[model samples]
Each structure stands twice: as structure tokens, then as C-alpha cells.
Target: MFYLAFFYPVYLGIFPNTFLNNHIIVIGIYGPLALFTTIIVFGVGFPILRSAYISLRDHRLTVDVLISLSAIVTYGYSITSLAFLGRQFLFFDVATTIIVIAIVSNQIRAKYKRRAVRELTGRLRNAETTVYRLTDEGETETIAAEECEEGDLFLVRPGEHIPLDGTIVDGQGTVNEALITGEARPQRKRPGDDVIGGSVAIDGAFEIQVGENATSTLDQLRDLVWNLQADQTNAERLTNRVISAYTVFVCGLAVVTFAAWLALGETGDSAFLTALTVLIIACPVSLSLVTPLAIGRGLSTAADRGIPILDQTVLERITDADTIVFDKTGTLTTGEMHVADVETSEAADEVLQRAAAVESRSSHPIAAAIRAHVTEPTQSTDFERHRYGVTATIDRETTAVGSPALLDELEWDCPPSIEESILHIRERGDLPTVVGWNGEATGVIALSDTPRKRWEDVVESLSAENRRIVMITGDDPRVAQQFEDHPAIDEVFADISPEGKEEIIQDLKKKGTVAMVGDGTNDAPALTAADLGVAMVSGSDFTVTVADALVTTDDLLPFVDLFEIARKTRRRLVENLTLAFLTPIIGLPLAAIGAVTPIVAAILMSAGTILVLANSYRPIMSQDSA
Candidate 1:
């Protein structure tokens, strides 16, 4: 229909004066062909008519109603002229041309949007990851990664990806943690060290005991990217308001213009044609396309860079944050525990034996640090666990190993060396625990957690802005002192619980927006409580669901990239919307008067739409999606 509308006039001009001119031949062949062509063009107008009808039934007007009315007037005028005037006045060609342009432009817009979303969710596609799952018989059975569940053991070989988030139960390996941390260095993993799935074992093969999160972190990341790309943002609400008001303004202006012209003693057909021109000139394609195109591109581009925006509203809220709170463990720190010092009351060997005997029975990180220094097991039995520490029978005597509370519960007294050990640990930013033999303080165990490779850089970048950076931790006073002394960190809280973190976030909310960043089970509550919750992809599954956005890697470098994307997206949105509003506002009065013809009006509408589309697809701040 579009082609016929464009080329039919040229065809008629080339033919002989009387060619195909027989009344019977013209009526039977050309006449019927023209009628068939009309039906196809009318079919193209179906969507416009349907949308117009629905909008009218709801007592509202839309851009579709204006387009449909213009097409109807043209087609009806041409048909009535051909039937009654014994000659044709064809506007079907022009109407068909407009319909074609609208459909094609919308398709192009959708193409760009899908390209963005596909780039974000490309990694989410379910891929078959191989693994060696341990059977009930204690033998390895080859299986897909998804088939292995919590508590299942999987063997990973050199250069193979770790198939699940679990503890290293057997063998030793150097695993490249680049997938989670964005740092390419290989981290050595011994028995009992936690290994993240999707990381490659660089050297020796190792057996991992899977934890409760059975779904591969990469798989969860894919699903999260998909959701973020598809979800509608608050920006859409702003555009929707413009659409509603624009529709009413256009319809009401057309009616008033037609009435004023008729009252001025103009002919009915002249007045009506001018009204039709006004409607055709003011299509709102540009209005609807602005928000989705800009925001969708931002999300997809951000995702490509390993920054996943989980919610549309998060982009808006982040800019409003007055304070940025960071969790200590699994966030600012590496979350891995390392033995720092050992202070013995009597014999260093005796205190270590008791700590290891109880620690060896568990998979906790504190236990791993204690096990690293201890050599001999005391053949302990009847091990008991508590919130403060672990208790068991060691050397046929009851032994307690943990915090000061655990020692107090056992009626053990803190010796002078024990008090000095606590002070030393705090000075160096390491955790200290009291070790007791029977009912006397025997020694102290001090462990330290190191900061991430990019922790300082991230802190420096964030501190460059006027925003306040606070560190919240459930760790000891030593860890709290670490943040307090750091120049980048403004404030620090020590010995906070999961509930305490949430309470702090709630209090911060009263002043202004607060963003909480975390990557552990304890951080989930605080992540949910913040105005804008950002979780590192290395965090727990529960943490992922609660966060507004998630960085795919532990690299703090991408935060600057995230804020840059949001700023650019918002700028583009405003530019497109302003063009959509202004061009139409200037064109409407001209269309209503005799100043503009229908052809010129259609062309202007088409141009406005193209301008908006061009702006929507403009490249973001940086071309490097890397």
C-alpha cells in the first residue's frame, strides 16, 4: 500500500490518454483493483481505530485518536467524492503513507531497546555447567551444576570452574577470584576455605562442600539482569502525565479552532479540513518513546559493565543519598579470617589444642583461623555450640574457647596477659578471643580480616563527593577502629548485630536517602532497610532479593560507572521530552489556521518523531562497555 501510494501517480502519467479506458474494462479490472488496494490501506488503520475507540470510550484522548480521525476524514472524503462526483479525489495514498511511517519508526525504536536489554540479559541464558557431584556412597558422579544441591560435595579440577558456593573439604588449590572480586589475582584455598562458584581453580583439584545456596551465583545474576532490564522505572510516570495532558490539549484546541473558523463565516469543508490538518500534525510518537529508550539503554549498558540496576526507582534515589553506609565484613574487608597472633597464659601448645579441637568440628571462618595454627587434636568428644563460643571435653576436662562472655560462663578469670592481648588486637585492628582451660584463662587468639584490593580506591572516590561515608560492622572493636582511623570513612559503629544495622539505616532515613552496601547473610536486613540497597554479587541469595541494585563483582570501581549511567540517562530523557513538547506546541496553531497544509503537517510530525528517536539512541558518556 505504501509503494502504491507513492508510485501510482507516475504510472497514470506515462500511459496513453485512453489506455485501459473502456468503461467495462476500467470498472471490472482497474476499479476493482483500486478498491482492493483501499481495503489493504484501511487494514493498516485498524490499530489506530481500535486505540482511538478505547480512548474515547474511557472519556480520554490519545495521539492514536488524532491519527485515526485524520485517516478516516481523508478516506471517507475520497470515497464519497469518487462515488458521487463521478471522479476520484484520492487521500488514501497519503493516509497509507503516514500509517507506514508510524509503524516502521516504532519498529526501529523497539529494535534499539531490545538490543540494549539483550546485552544485559545475555549471560542469563541457562548454560550447561558440568560438575562431579558426590553420591550417598561417597563416590563422585558427574552431573550438571544445577543438579547438585546444598550439603552436596563437588570435585573441581585445575582450570575448571568451581560449580557451587561451598567450603573446600579436600585438597588445595589457587582459585582466581576475578569473577567475584574483579581482581585477577589467584587466592590460595585450603581445606575449609569458602570458594565461590564460577571461579577457576588455577592449580590443584579440590572437593567443595556446597552450602545452602545451591543456585550458581552466575545463574542468579542472569535472572537479576533480566528483571532489572524489564522493570518499569519512576521516570515513566512523568512521561505518562505529559501524554494525558497533551491529548486533551490537542483535542480541545482542534474543536475550538474549527468552531472559531466556522463563526468567522468560512465554508464548512474549509473549516473541517483545517481541523483534520491540526490533528494529523500533532501525533505523539516522540512523547511515548523518550523514557523507555533512555532508561532501557542505561540499564543494559550498566549490566554489560557488570553493574546490575535491580529497580528503576533506585537510579533516582541514589542521587539523593546524603550518607553512604558500608558493612565491614564481606564488604570493605575480604571477609576471610587470618590468624594474626597467639598469647599463651602457660603453654601456647595447650591453648591451641583446645581451640583446634572445637574449631575442627565446624566450617566457620573463625574455626578455620584457629585450625591454621593448631597441629594436634586432643581427641575431644561431646562438642557443644553456643552464640559466644564452642564448648567440648578436651583431655577429659571441660574446655571453653570464644569471647569474654564464654569465659565468664565457664567461671574463668581473665589474667593480666589476656587484658594486654585485647589492647594489642584493637591497636592492630584484629579480633581477639579468650581461650580457657577448665576454669582459668589460658591464652587469647587474635585474627585479622584484610581490606579488598580496591577498597581504598572506592573509599577515595566516594569521599571526593560531599556525601558522608559511614562504616557499619558486627565485628569487634578492632575492626570498628579500622574504619574510624581511615581518612575516607567519616564515622564507624562497632559490635552491631543484623537488627542493629537495620535500626541504624532506619534512623539515617529520617535525615535523607541512605544507601547500604553489603555482601553477607547479616547484611541482608540492613540492605533491605536502606533507601537504596546495593549488594555485591558475591553476597547471599537473600541479600540479592532485598537489594535495589547489585554490582556483579566486588570491585568498587564500577560505582562511578553506575552514577555516570544514571546521570546520562536522565539527561537524554529530559532532552527528548522537551523536544516532544516544544515542536508540537509551536506547530499546532499553524496547523489550525490556513498557514500549513496536511502534507506539510504530516512531514513536520514525522520529523519531530525522528529527532526524538535519534536523541534516544545517542551513545552514553563512555563507549567502553568493558
Candidate 2:
């Protein structure tokens, strides 16, 4: 219909005196064709009309109503002219052209939005669905992930992805949970340790028992992203208001213009043409496209960089955060114990080897750290795990690796030097592990939670503009003191319970907008209380669900990127909105007079839409280049 309407004028210009252009031939054939074309356009545009009707029923005006009104008026006027004034006066092409432009513009806007959402969901929903399920006979069999119910056992091989959230029931492995927790470091999983689906087993193998509710973390994240993207943000609401008022004003003006022209004794055809121009010129296509396109691009770009914005409103709230609060464990630190220092009265290598031999058989985080520090552990026998530590015989000698409690349990004497070393290690906020042999404490392995790589850089960047950077932790003052002396941190609240964290968040809100970043169940309340909550992928399900945004990769650098994207997206929204309104502001008056025709109005509206689209894409394109 658009092509026929557009080419009819060219056909006339090329063969003005041809038989096809004869008055009788045009009336008998082309007139009906033009009417047929208008009907087809209307049919194609029924959804637009239906939307406008629904909006009117609810006492609301939208750009769809304005576009529908323009098409209806043009079609009605052209049909009346064709019946009485003949073919020369018929303006069927104008009606078809307007609806065609509206439809094309809407599709173009929807295409960009759909592409962004598709890309984001695709990245998050990459978990494997086929898995090895253990059958009643205790043999592994292939099965779909969804087919496995609660209490079902599954075996994951050395490099296979875990298919569902489950606890380790047997065996052990180093699982790379980067896709789920954003942490690049592979976690050691053993019996009783919970493992998320979608994480790959980097080494070893495990038998996992499905949780009570069998679901993949990847599925949860994908659903959450879709839900978040569907919501209307503050900016979208403001745009709707502007579009509604503009639609009402333009409709009223079109009616008044027709009345005034008729009152001035102008011909009815002349009055209707001018009014139709007014309706078409004031279409808010560009205005409607502004926020959504830019926001979609921003969301896609953020997701590509490993940050999924779960709430659209955060694009506005994130930049407003003046006080940034960080939960110490998992957020600032790696949340993994590492061997910071090793002290032994005897040869350090012999003591560490003996400790690592026993610790290697345990899944405790401290044991992992001790094992990680040793190059080669000697073979140990009679391995016995205890609440405080592990006891085993290494090299025909009984050895113990644990804390002071473990030494007392084993009736091993702690040397004064070893006791002093333990005290010093505790004073420095490190967990002290005592290694004993020959019935005496021999060494104190000092282990501490390692801070995440580039954490200091994150603090520095966030605090660069004098924004207050605060750290809150449930750890005792001694454990939390390591972060307190950081130059960029303005304050530190140690030994705060989960409830106390929420109270601190509320208190900080009293001063200014607060953004809390955390990755633990204990951080849920604080996350909900803050203006913006950012959760790491390693966090508990409750924490991730409550967070406004998620860091899909285990890295803090994305926070900087996230804030930058939000600011750029906000700027693009304003620029696009300005472009959106420029068309109606400048074209309406020209259309009200006789300066602009329906075709010219359509061209101007389309141009404005093109400008807004180009401007909306600038931020994402620039990010890609950078």
C-alpha cells in the first residue's frame, strides 16, 4: 500500500496524457484502487486503532490515538471527496502513507528492544540441560535436567557443567562457578558443600543430590532479567505524560483549526487538508521511541560486560548514590581463606607438608588453604577428622593440624612460642591453625580472607569524587580491622548483625542516596533497605532476588562500568527526548498555516524518529569502541 501510494504520483507525472491517466479510466479503475488501498492500510493498522480505543476507554490519551485520528480523518475526507468532487480531489494516498509510517516506526523501535533482550537472556540462559542422573540402582544414566526431581542424585564429571542446584553427597571437585557467582576463582566443593548449577567442574568429580526444589540458577537469572526489563521506569512514566498531553493538545488544535478556517469562509476541502496536516505533523513517534531504545542499548551493553541490570529504575538511582556501602565478605574480599603466613619451630617445609597431608583429606576452607600452601604432602594414614582439626599419622609419626581446641582435644602440648605466634596471628585478624607432632605444637599457619583483586582500585574509583565509601561486616572488629585503615574508606562498621546492617543502611539514607553491594544471605536486609542494591552472583538466592542489579562475573570493576553506563544512558534519554519534541514544536505551526502538507508532515516525523534512533545508539557504539 505504501509503495502504491508513493508511486502513483510518479506514474501520473511520467504519463500525464496516457490512456491510463484518462479521467474516465482513472475514475472507473484507479479511484476504486485508491479506496481499496486505504482499506488495506486500515486493516494493517487495526492493532494501532485497537490500542487507541483501549486507551480512550480508560480516559487516557496516547500517541497511538493521535496517529489513529489522523488516518481516520484523512480516509474519511478522501472518500467524501472521491464521491462528490471526483478523482483529482481524492487524498487516499495521504491516509495510507501516515499509517504506514507509524507501523514502520513502531517495528523499528521494537526490533532494537527485542534484540537487546534476546542477547541478554541468551548470555544468562546458557546452562546445560542434559545431565548424568543416578538411578535407583545407583548407576548413572543420562537424563534431562528438568526431569530430575528433589533428592535425585547426579554425577558430574571432571569438566561437565552441573545441571541443577544441589549439595555434594560424595566425591569432590574444583568447580568454576564464574557463570553463576561472577567469581573467576574455582571453588573447592566436597561432601556437604552446596554447588550451583551451570558451574563447570574444573577438576575431579562429584555426586550431587538435588535440592528440595530443583532449579538452575541460570534459569532464575534469565527470568529475573526479563521481569526487570519489562517494568516501566520513572523516565518512561515522564515520557508517557509528555506524549499524552501533547496528543490532547494536538487533537484540540486540529479541531479548532478546522473550525476557524471554515468560519473564515474557506472551502471545506481546504479546511480539512490543513486539519489533517496538523494531526499528522504532531505525531509523537520519536518521543515514544526515545527512552526505550536508549535503555535497551544500555542494558544490552551492561549485560555483555557481565553486569545485568535487574531494575530499570536503577539507571536513575545508581548515579544518585552519594554513599556507597560495601559488605566486606564476598563483596570486597574473595570470601576464600588463603595462607597468608606460616610459622614453625622446626623446618617449615616438614611442618607444612605434615599439616597439608592431613588437611588435604578435609573440605574445610582453612584446610584447603594449608594444602594450597604446600607443594607436596606426604602420605598420611588413619586420617580422622575432628570439629577443630584433623589428626593423622605422617611418615610413621602422629601429626595434628588444627586450632588450640584441636591441640587440647588431642592432649598435645602447645609450646610457648607457638602460643605466642597464635596470639600474634589473631591480633592481625588471621585464623591461627596449629600443627603439632611429637605431642607438642610445632607451627601456627596464619590464614586470612584474601581481598579480591582490584578491590582497592574499586574503592579508589568510587571515592574519587569525594563520595563516602563505607564498609559493613558481620565479622568481629579484629577480622574487619584490615579494611578500616584503607585511605579511601570513610567509615567501617564491624560486628554488625544483619539487622544492624539494615539500620546502618537507613541511617546512611538519612544523609544521602546509598548503594549497597553484598553477596551473602546476611546482606539481604541491608540490600533491600538501600536505594540501590548490587549483589554478586555468589550470593544466596534470597540476596540475589532482592538486589536491584547483579554482577554476573566475579569482579568489582563492573561497578565502575555500570555507573558509567547509567549516566550515559540518562544523557542519551535527554538528548533523544529533545529530538523527539523538536518535530512537533517546529512543524505544528507551519502545518496549521498552509506551509506544510500531509506528505511533508510524514517526512518530518520520520526524520525526527531517525535522529532519535541515531542518538540513542551513540552510547552503546561508543562503549563498544572503547
Candidate 3:
């Protein structure tokens, strides 16, 4: 019906003597049909006009303003020419095509965003595991996983997922923690073993006690990813600003083109048509889409690989960073501390027992290592925790276990032999804690942590192209000696206090852009101080909250993946932006000179939008294939 009504005038021009060309036939049939078609098209395209009005009211301009102005000009001119001139010089098709194309382009962008969001939030929506809660009568009662609170006891049978982050209190089992740590091997779980919420128990049954903070790690990660997905990046903001200014310039140029053509003795209709063509050709649709489409793909790709970017701007910052600072403990090492050896003047077992008793009530990693080393736990009283260590009364005697500095603070006598042993332990890159009592230093316990698997490859990948790699830790300087000679490591700062870590990051920023990767609470200050802060999955909650990016695995290889993704995403943005500008640069001149018609300009605008969409999907498609 629309096509018949639109081409009725052409039909009449070709067959002037036909019965359909009569005055009454033209008024009752073609005129009303054409008017109805125009009304329908305008109604369907109301959103574009509304958006243009809102932007104008706010004292700003956008691509919508240009598209709306072009459509309105064509429609108004066609109506006036029909009413006053008694000639149907209609360009309603141009107006309808432009509005339809704009609507389609917006739908394409919305669909792309929806797909990306679905990919990120799918795991969260599917988390509905059932938990078996232990009742006060020692009977198990089934409950929804989210309903379980902290301090609640639950039973996890074989082949079942752990309902929440908690400690195993009764049973031993083998748990596959791949979902949390990215380690494929099954980890053995016994009493006091910490288990993540998403991990599955491979064998044996276990009664678990929820941690004080029983919120599921998976849930927290999902919420974080979801919240960050909507954040706009710096590149996106810059592009928006460019588009706004470009829209204003295009609108002004269209007006100038109209006046110049009329001044050159062209008719009003011809001059107005040229101005409308200019508006159609210079629409900034592609420019507005360049950064957001690329960023959406980049973030979705990162989330799929267990790396959630908490800030979309981190991608830009990470690519710009010249220096990468790593925290020693959980960032590069497994962070599972174990007592490798014990040295003492007195019996070794007796010293271990006394140290364990003193550290029993502390929740520090070193305390857990000491407690785990001694099988038969001894009781202690009058427990006191110092800044550097802990002291407790065991068997009516005060036993202290911590750094050598703790003994010096207490004015305890440190025998030369004990001091020499501590020095040797530090030289071997092992953590040394002094176990002293009776107003004298008795022994030193050397605890060791293994470097994370594939750490060397991660470091080498990140240290490419003269980029500097630095490691900082609170341990003794000698403990960091192991990394001092690493070819990829450019510097090592050891025995640095938490405040000192922040100072180091600030100082490094002066030399170049710095990115700090860490996992512990002490690293929180530094994480906040760096240009880009990345936190491991095992990091303290505070560190994760402050960091810009969170790697949802114990492995450091995500750092490599993240940097590569950022670089590729940035490159894609450049490619898309360049393609976006090329259309207007080449078409505007032809449009202003009356060589390009409104219909052809609309086609070119749509083609530009399609080109940007395809270019933005290149990295995402390649990532999927890989």
C-alpha cells in the first residue's frame, strides 16, 4: 500500500490520460493514502525526534539531532510544496529510510550489549545449589544454599559442591577447587582445611563449618563483575565528547552549505535538498559506537577467562603502564606457608610445641603454619598479640614466637647461635620466626612457600618490550634474594612496611605509569596508590574492593591474558574510530557540492555503522575461536 501510494505520481506522469488521473480519483485515493503513509512513518520514528528535543533542551547536541533535523526538513518541504505549489515533489522515502536506519542501528547496539551482559551474569543466575544443614540434634536438614548463615554447620557429600566458603570440621575429602584456584588437581581436605564455595568435593563426606563471613565467593565475584560491566571507560567518554562536537560542526556546516548554494543562484528546493543530504551523510553513528562495542567485547572476553575487570578504565590504564609491581606472598607464590625446618639449642619438638601453643589463638598465616606443624596442640593462657608476634603463658612460663625484632623489643637475650641460625634461614629465602622464652631466644622456625606454577612464564610475558618488573614484600631482604637475580625482575624492595609499599608505588609513578598486583590486606594501600591495581582471587576482601581488576584464580597467567586483551581492545578502538571518520571526510565534500543525494547519503551512513560493528567484533570472534 505504501509503495503504491508513494509511486502514484510517477504512475500518473507516465499515463496522464488514464482514469486514475482524474481530479476526484487523485483527491480521494492518492492524496489521503500519501498523507496516511507519512503519518505512520513519522509516528514510528517519534523516538528519534524525542531524543533530539531532549538533547537540545539540555544545551547539547548528538547524532540524533542531525538525523531528526534532516527528516523534519524533508517532510516539511514535501508538505508545503504539495499544499502551496500544487505539485507533489515528495521525498518522504528519504525521511522514512533515515529514521528506519537509525532505529536499526540502535537496536544492533542494544543487542550487542544484551549478549555481553548475559554472558557475564549467566553463572550468577544459575547458582541454586542445595545445602544440607546440621541441626542442633545432630540431624541434617536440607536448605537453600543462600539461606545458610555464618557459623552454620553443613554436610557436603561426595560429588557435591561446597555450599559456601567455610572450614572443614569433621570429615576428610578430596575437593576439586579448579573453579576457584584454576588448579586442576584435586586438593585433599581435612579438619581445619579452608574450602571455597564453588568447589566440588570429589570423594568422602565432610561436615563443614561456615566462616565468620559466610557470603559465597562466587556471588561476590558475580556481583562485582555485573556492577563493573556498566561502567564507561575513558576512551568511551572521549569518543562521546568528540561526537557531540562533531554533531554541532556538522549541523553548522549543513546550514552554511544551504546558504552558499542559494547564494550561488540555486533554487530554494535544490539548496535545501543539498543541506539535507549533508546532514544525512555526516551523521556520527559509527563514531558514537566505536569505543563501547569494543569495550563490551573486551570485558566479556575477560570475564569468560576468570578475570573480572572491576573498572572498565583499567584496560586503558593497563596498556599505558610501564612498570608492573607485584606483591611477593600471594601474588607470585602459592601463599600456603609450611614449616620447612626447625633449629634450636633445646629439643626441637619441645620448641615446636611451645611455639604452636603461643600462636594457637592467632589467625595470621604464620600462626596457622606453626599450629599445623605441631600435631598435638598444647594449651596456653594469658595470650597477648604484639604488632610483630604473639606471646602467651604456657605451663606458667611466657612463650613468644614471631620475628627476631619481637625478641629485641622484649629485651630478651638472643644467643649468638640462635641469631646466626636466623640469618642463615633468611639467606635461604625462608621466613624466620623466633621462638623464645625464659628471657632468651631459644630457636628459629623457617617457614617456606613455593612459587606459583608457571610464575616464570607469567613474568616473562609481562616483562616484554623493556617494561620493568618490580617485587615488594614485608619479609626480610634476604628472603627476597631468590628473585633478585631473575632476568625479568628489574628491582626488588623487601622488608617494606605497608605504608612504605604505598610510598614506593607513588615514587614509581613519577618514573612511569605503575600497576600494582597484590593479594593481601597490607597491599591494599599500594593497590589504591598505583595507576592500575590488580588483585588475585585469593586476596583479602578489602584488597579486591580497592583494586581495579580482580583475577578470579590463583594463577598469575591471567595477568598476561589481561594485558594482551587490553592491547588488542585498544587497537580495535583505533581501527573502528578511523573507519568511522573516513565516511564523513570523503562523503561530506560530495554531499555539499550536490553530487550525493539524500537516499545515497542514508545508505552510506548505514554502511559506516555496519563497518564499525564488524571491526569491533574481530577480537571477540578470534578469542572465541582460540
Candidate 4:
């Protein structure tokens, strides 16, 4: 529509049409001019006029009011010129060009935004795939992965994704967890090895015993990305403030230009033409758009790469972040536990068999680990359960398999050698299970959850920026010490309940901006309490919803990238506001002195708007490949 109105005059200048006719409202010869005039007045002018009317009715200042006032003045004056001044000073082209530039730039901006929305929706569709479930012995059924629940058995064939966060109860395979951990190497998994929901089984078939409910990690990631793409930040409110001030200034300058020209011995029409020039020159059409354009472009860039930011204030608030808090399980360290080391007074095999015999009856995660290592058939009597472990009779001997608290309760004494080994395991940030027979300590099984391959590097980079890294977890201090031991970590608060985590965040906020990173339902309260909540898409659904920045990828380094992008976004807004302000400053004074014409004012104003639109379209993430 803008193209037709913009280029119609060019066609008339070259072809020289003789279809000139006179209109009812004004006495003048009209040809293609009549059609072009109507298109410009209605196509672009209506929205401008409607917006200006709204601003006036609502008692607000807006850029649209400035554009509409300028367009109306030029248009009405041109009609009067055609009626009485011989059509020599008609400024119809100037009025139409104002709308043309706005329309073109706006259309281009909308197209890019639409493309980004499509891509994010595509990723959401791809994340949910079908899975195979175990129904009974040697029988399987196909089901959606989200329908599987805790303790349900599932099957994974070679090259298929592991359907849920579960233990490999049967078969063997090599799992590639690159997408979830950013580790390129494939890890071998046999019976008893834990497999993440999103990791792919590279070889062999396996039976996975699901640990929790069916919501897959991919589903969480897809939702977080979608939420962020739809949220717009405070940049828009800032734009409105700038536009309000600019509109008032422009209106005041145009009135001053009109009065000054009349005092310089100019006729009423000539003075008004000078005022028209000022209105066209001072209109801040571009100022209204700079905020959304730059911000939308940044958001679109993030979504295209599967990193969705679902908060309005995270990027801005993160600029001053001095404290970085991490949740221990599933955030800093993978939640899967492995038998790190084994110590036994008797043969290793005998101690494991006796422990497994007592643990096989329980469904606890630690029990599964012990059973994976050793299995035995024995009758149990006088069985009892405790919060930390279990005690029972095996082969007519009293057997205990649990924590040291369980050891102390039964009046069982650990040998000096076994006690030393238990202390050593605790110091290494590993979970230790004590096993004994006939009230005598036998062995200790140490289990540890490994940290991600990139955690150390990411932590070091964050610390280089003067960020204080803290880890808060429900795990015992002894179980969290390995992460706290890193040189990059500033503090560790361990053995915390969910409520305790929230309190720690509240305390940290007193010092400076705090960002809490976690990946579990238990972390939801803490995530909401922090100034900036960062969560992994692989975490619980509740945690994802409350988090400000959701890391769709496995790596935690995007927070750094987001901080930089936030800075750049601030810079972009300043650049746009500066550029928009410079146009009226240079053109308003010349129009007041009767030195600048209305056509020149339109040209200058359009040029400033185009420059801002162009700058806003630049991909912000390209600055650092964010």
C-alpha cells in the first residue's frame, strides 16, 4: 500500500497523464493526484489520526498525535492551496511519504518476529515423542512417554531416547548424554546404572525402571522457551515515557515556529506553512518503536536457538547480580548416583551380598544401587525399617544396612578401620551406607552424584566477573563438600529443607542481587524468593514456571550471555533515543527561521526514523554468539 502511494507520482511525472479533473471540495485540476491523495490520507492517516484522538481523549502524549497533527496540517493546507493559491504550494507528497516509511519498516519488523514464533513452536512439537512400555513378562505396549509413572518399567532399543529418569534394571548400553550434559563422550550403562530421561541409548537394549512421574525433561524445556518468548520487559514502558516528553516538546516547538514566523513579517498562510514544516520535522514516529523492535529482535534471536527467556525483568535485574546461588542436586551435579568406592573388612563380594539381601526389599534409590552391585537369595525374619536404613535377620545373624545413625541405634559398634573409611567417604562428598553382621561392622558403600563436565569452567567464568557462587542443598554438608571445595565457590549451605532454602535466599538478598539456580520441585519456593530465578528445563514443572531464566540447553553458561545481552539492549535503547532526539533539534530551529521547507522537514524526519528502525533490526545476540 505504501509502495503504490510512494511511487505513483514518479509514474505520473514520466507518463504525463491528461486525465486531470476538478473535485467538489476544492477548485483545481486533479488526475492521478486525486487517487494518490486518497490512499495516503486514509491508508496511513487513519491509524495516525485514530491514535492521536485516543491520546487526546485519554489525556496522554504519544508519537501518533505528533504524526497525525503534522499530516492533518499539511493535508488541509494543501486543499486550501488548491482552492485559492493556484495549487503551487501543495504538500500532498510530503504527507504521504510520512506514512510510507512507517508502514515499510513496521511490516519488515513483524515478519521477522513471526518467523521466530514458528521455530519455537516447532521445537515444542518435536520434544514429545512416542515410547515403548513394558506391560508384563516378554510383552510391551506403545505409550506416550508422559504417561509412565514411578516404578513403571520401560524399554529402550539402541538409538532410541531413554524415556524417563530411571535405573537400568536389565540389559546393557552406552548412553550419549551430550544434549543433556554437554559431554560428548558416551558413558557405558549396565544393570543398576541410572539413565536420564533425555539421553539416547547408543547401543544395546535395556529395561529402565522409572523413578518419578512421566513428564519428560524435553517437555519442561519446550514450555520454558515458549513462556519467555511471549514476555516483554520494562523497555516498552521507557519508550512510552520518552515519547510523551518528545510529543509535548514537538508540539510546543511547532507553535513557537508559527508565532515567530508571523512576527518576522510573514503572511498568515506563510507562517502556518512554517509551522507545518516544524510539525513534520519534529514528529517522533521512530521514538515510539525503538524499544519493542530492539527487544523483540533480541527475544527472537534467543528463541531461534532454543533458549527461551520467560521473564520481563531478568535481563535488567541481572546486570547488578553479585551473588549466584545453585541448588546441589540436578543443577550443579547430575541427580544420578553412582557407587564411587567400596570398603569391606571381609571379602568385598560377601559384604555386598549381605547388604543387598536386606536392601532388596526396599525401593529406596540407595537400596537400588546396593542391589545392583550384589544380589543374594536368603530368608529374612524379624525385619524392621528405620528412617535412614533397615535391620533384619539373614542366615540367623542380625544384619544392618543403613546410615551410621542406624548403626548407633542398634548398639552396633563399627570397627576402628570401618569408622575411618566412613569418615573418609563423608569428606569426599559421597553418601555412605554402613553394613554389619552379628552387631559387627563389615563394610561401607560410598555413592556420589557427579558434577557436569562444564560446571568448573562455568563457575570460574562467573567468578571472574566478581560473582559470588553459593550452593544450597538438602544433601548433608559432607555430601556437598566436593562442590564447595572448588576455588570458584564462595560458600555452601547444606542439609537445608525447602523452607530453609527460601530463608537463605532472603538473607542473601540483603547483601545484593541474588540469582537462585535449581532443578527440582523442592526448589520452587526458593526460585520465587530470589531476585532472579534460573532453572534448568530438565527440572520439575513447578521450578520451571517460577524461574526467570530457564536454561534450555544443558550448560549453565547462558546466564552470562543473558547478562551481556541485557547490557547491549540497554545500549540499543540509548542509541535509538539519541538518534530520535537529534532530528528535531537540528530541524526545528531552521523551520522557525523560515529557512527550511516542509518537504525538507519530511525528508529529515523520515531519514531519522529509518535509521532507528534499521539499527533496531540488528541481531543483538551476534555480538557474542549468545
RMSD of each candidate?
Answer: 9.1, 8.1, 9.1, 10.1
Q: After best superposition, candidate 2 residue 232: deviation in angstroms?
A: 0.8
lDDT of 4 by residue, 1-626 (tens): 54344334533464232332224223333435555776777775676778779999999887777777777777778777765665444677777777666666557656655554554556556546456787875445778777777888877754456757889887675676654575757799988988877666654567889886545656645544544436556777777887788778777887887787788888888888888888888877777667766666665555444455566466567888899999887678765666777898788877777777776445334666776775453555445555446777888998998876667778888899998998998887687788898888899988877786588887898899999999897666788878878999999997675557889999999999898888623365577679988876652222234466667666676756777677887788788878877888888888778788888888899889888887776668665232
Off by over 4 Å in 1: 1-89, 105-109, 112-116, 126-145, 148-225, 229-231, 340-419, 433-445, 538-543, 624-626
lDDT at 495, model 2:
56
Q: Pull out the clashing pairs in model 4.
A: 228-309, 228-310
What's model 4's overall lDDT? 0.71
Off by over 4 Å in 2: 1-24, 27-36, 128-147, 150-219, 339-422, 427-445, 476-482, 497-499, 520-522, 538-543, 620-626
Write down the worst ten-residue block by lDDT for model 1: 537-546
- CA error at residue 219 for candidate 2, angstroms: 4.1
lDDT of 2 by residue, 1-626 (tens): 55455345643565454654577866776567666766756688888899999999999988888888888887787677556665454456667777777788789777766655664556545543666787886545777678888998887654445778999988765776655676856688879999887666644557899997766745755655556657788998988998888887998999999998999999887898898899888877777788888788787777677776777788888988999999987789876888888888889888888988876545345666777788777877666555456678888888998766778778889888998898888898886778888899999888888788899999999999678999997665667777898899999997565557889999999999999998633365577679998987642222245577777666798888888888888888888988988998899999988798777787787888888877876755354731
In model 4, the worst 10-residue window by lDDT is 16-25
Clashes found in each candidate (C-alpha, N, C closer than 3 A)? 0, 3, 0, 2
lDDT of 1 by residue, 1-626 (tens): 44354336533565444653447644764466557547645676677678879988998666666666666766666566556644332455556656766666667656655665564355455345567786775555778777777888876644446767889988675776654565655788899899887665654567789887655755645555545546567788767666778777777887888898899999877787787778777877667678777776776777677666667666666777779999887678776887777888567787887788766544445666787777665666556655466677877887787766666556678888788887787677788877786677788888888787778878778788778899987667665775688898898887665457879999988888788887623365577568887876542232244567777676776766777777888888889888877667888878887798666677787888888887776777667431
How far does residue 363 in candidate 2 sit from its true spot (Å)? 12
TM-score of 4: 0.69
How much is the lDDT of residue 121 in candidate 3?
Answer: 59
Worst 10 residues of 2 by lDDT: 537-546
